[model samples]
Target: MPRQDDAGSESEHGKIPKSTFEIYRAEGDSQFRNKSFLKAIECYTQALEIKPGDQYCLVNRSKCYLNEGNIAKALADAEESLKEDAAFHKGIFQKAEVLYFKGDFENALVFYHRGHKLRPEMEEFRLGIQKAEEAINNSVGDPSVIKLRSDGDLSFFYAAEEKKKPAARSSYQKPKKEDSGPKRAQRNKAPADSKTIKKMLGDLYADREYLEKLLREESAKARKTEHSEKIQDLCIEGLNYLDSRSEFWQQQKPLYSRKKSAMREAAEKDKSSAAKYVIATLEEIDNKQTAGEHEAAIKQATRLLRTVEKWSPEDLQNREEIRANLHSLIGNSQFELERYDQALASHQADQKIGEEHELEESQARSRDNIGRVLAKQGNFSEAIQVWEQRLESSKSLSPMESTWLHHEISRCYLELKEFNKAKELAEKALSYANQMGDNQWLLNTNVLVAQCEVRLKNYASAAGNFDSALEHARIVDNALAIDAINRAIQDVNQKLVEEEKRLEEERQAGEQGEGDAKPDEAAGGEEQQQQQQQQQEQQEPVQQQQQE
Candidate 1:
């Protein structure tokens, strides 16, 4: 619910300067705190104009308007702020507050509960709900007489009312010893004095024995099922006492050690049950991811992994399997966030664990993930090598799996411009896909084969392969695949036409050159005869000149 500006800088004409906006917003806050509602509204309006859609300004203005008795404006501002961010608890609370003052207790209660659901720790929402419910109940008896009060007046009234309330006695006071029967005295002594309680929870934590004894006695007096509950209560009490004392006591190491030991014992006792808990937690994490709550999913998965790591090696039923799965889950979450290095590290850890445990399927999956991450990083060579090694090592691969690996390898080859290799692998993949009757794989392999043909300049063959791919895509009802195939077909057709046009132009240029060469040869022979006759005439002229 924290307010944040949308990405990108606003144009000069679209927004006031950031510094100016901040100044106005600050002035608005000052006026709001001073109860100058009208001035506050003006300042907030200026801020909003400077940076329109500012959630904080909207919420503040709503509060000002509500305080100034302008219910319509208050409601409008509150609703607008919520429309900008429905999950903003402040806006939800503001809307609820406005409704409460407007005497619309029913609607107020609804938004109050919504705000509470969003942020359970906010005391204002709890108080608001209490007040709203009270108003609703009171209105049932005297609907017309129910009056509304501003938040400021209400706050002052509550303060005055609190001062009028009586204070309770101190915890330090002790009861005086009284003359009573032996049985009554014994009952009074059972609840230990403060000194005894302090001594019992002090230094060596020596009172642990006394606490356990009490638990045992309590269990003996209760039903069998209640024994565990008694024990849990005793442990909680002891831990709480230790925590309280540690704040003032110098020696906290023992307290911390005790807490740690308690946690470890509980974890060891529930190791078997941990699997079901872990499975449920993992499913929740997956749900978060599917809901696009990536950040929350990452945090939950991380905490779960840490908790799992706390279990001793001997306590875990399937240690390596749990570790591998958790690491893979973390890697997937990280990958979604585009944190490639962290994802690679996580996948590698999973792969190492799988290899150490001799879990072939897990190891293969980890390797596949590693390859995928590598490919995403544009490390095609490494990705191809990893996948190829996996394919070679996997002797028991199903036809579909083999086809997938072939398709992956061919894709890498295509990226590397090794068209012939790509074509070869794609064809093999297509055959396996057809044999396995996997329409999706068949469509993908066909597209890959067509791509390779295009890279090799076999336009007609590429177009035909794409046509087959398009047909398969149609059968599968994959609109994206159909669209991609159609576009590929158009591209191939365009390339074919361009190629034919280029060839025809080259052929015409060759024919024209041949004709020009024949004419030049004939002209050359005529020019040589004329030059010889001219040379004879020049020799005669030279002789006549010499005689003269």
Candidate 2:
């Protein structure tokens, strides 16, 4: 089995990032070279999941399936590999090879011819054609006589009826001479001597003048000088070079060509084995968090974050986005654990990345998370600011999300004793809830609105809103909420009664005070009249004195 640790690194944070697809595919190739077909299939399957419809992965997987003797699966993969491009030469060769292995020599031959027509430079197709023909000849005797015209041209369509019968032989004895000269063809078969060797070397290496001269000198030295062993060694070296070249073109180059094309496209998307693995690991962290394994999730996310920080620009397409998400994951896990300070830092980091990159969605998420963390820590003022900023800055927020944000903001305002602001936001939240038609949100928002009203001393309105909330709670079948709303309604009704009594007492006090003020006014007028009469008398005396 392949090393699981290498498949997913836990702590190699400073290494150059390799693509997930490249890593897995390269591993698959290694396994294939080792004849580990099952392991190779696993690796290729992973590569395919990351990059669907990859020609190299599909064809290589087909080859693995073929090695496993899974003819059906092998053929299916081979056929699917060609679906994108029928002229994919590797796919053609693989399909033809599979058919030939499955004993369908006729179809194999057809595909081989097709491949040959498409890519004449490919030696595999030529070899396939020859094998398929041999298989056909072995399976069914060649009834039609074929005439070899020059070197390779053949008269393959000659009718069986055209085959001529041998003519009747007439016996005529002739005397044979003893030890007659060897036939010209017999001498041609002998190993070449010095002069003949020179001529053969000249003709053989004509295209390579350098090799011709080298071989000529070597051959001369081998025959006439003491460097015979050197010439022999050189001959062996040449044979080995030819074998290696033939093997490379026949076995390796075709696969390399297929991979080159796939890698070109994968590069454009910044996809690789390591990148895909990182994505998968991120999903795993999400699952762990969802499953309530907060500690484990935090640990995994921390390690992955370290690794991600070392990633090259070419390693992953959304490097910054992935980094922000990792921060979010860690923050969320910390929040779940009630580690408010650590959660705040992580969320702040996430927000910083979002703002720097201008990622709207990331910014929205970070703000929401940070707000929740702050709210949990009793920092309602800052939490409210964060949520309101999200509401103002984000246009892509869903109606449900908007309702939640408004509702949260109202709660924060209510916490700060800002009744009017709380009431306004609560009403806004209620409208959004109505639009979404969510009974739970409706119940929650109505209760919130009622609380704001109560804080504002609107007892009657609070009672009415509580009744509305109670109805919604009933619709949602929330038993706890039903009991709570009933108690709240009772409290509001009591407050209303108290409010009415207070209003009545104030009214009576005003009426009595008005009556008393009228009496005082009458007495004061009488006193003023008396004072005016005395003043008139005094004034008359003063006027008489003044006239004397």
Candidate 2: minimum summed lDDT over ten consecutive residues — where? 183-192
Show pairs that collide, candidate 1.
Answer: none
Which predicted model would earn the best lDDT? Answer: 2
The backbone clash count of each candidate, in order, is 0, 10
The alpha-carbon lDDT assigned to residue 376 of candidate 2 equals: 75
| Residue-level error in angstroms, candidate 2, position 208 | 75
Residue 10 CA error for candidate 2 (Å)? 52
Q: List candidate 1 stretches off by more than 4 Å.
A: 1-271, 508-548
What overall lDDT, based on C-alpha atoms, would model 2 receive against the true structure? 0.67
Candidate 2: stretches off by over 4 Å: 1-272, 533-548
What shift in Å separates residue 289 of candidate 1 from its native position after superposition? 2.9
Q: Write the per-residue lDDT of candidate 1 for residues 1-548, one digit (tens) a residue.
A: 11334324678677524446777898899998887989989888878877777889988999888766566567778877866568899888988877665545567778888889999998677766665654443211112111112210000001101112123222112454882422210111121223323433455455655665665675566555545664656454553434334221211111111122222333345547776687668778865653335567778988988998998767666666677777877787676667899999999998999899886655887888888789778898999999888988886876656776787778777667687998899898999878766555566677777777877788898889888887876765555456546766777788889889999999999999999999899999999999999999989988999999
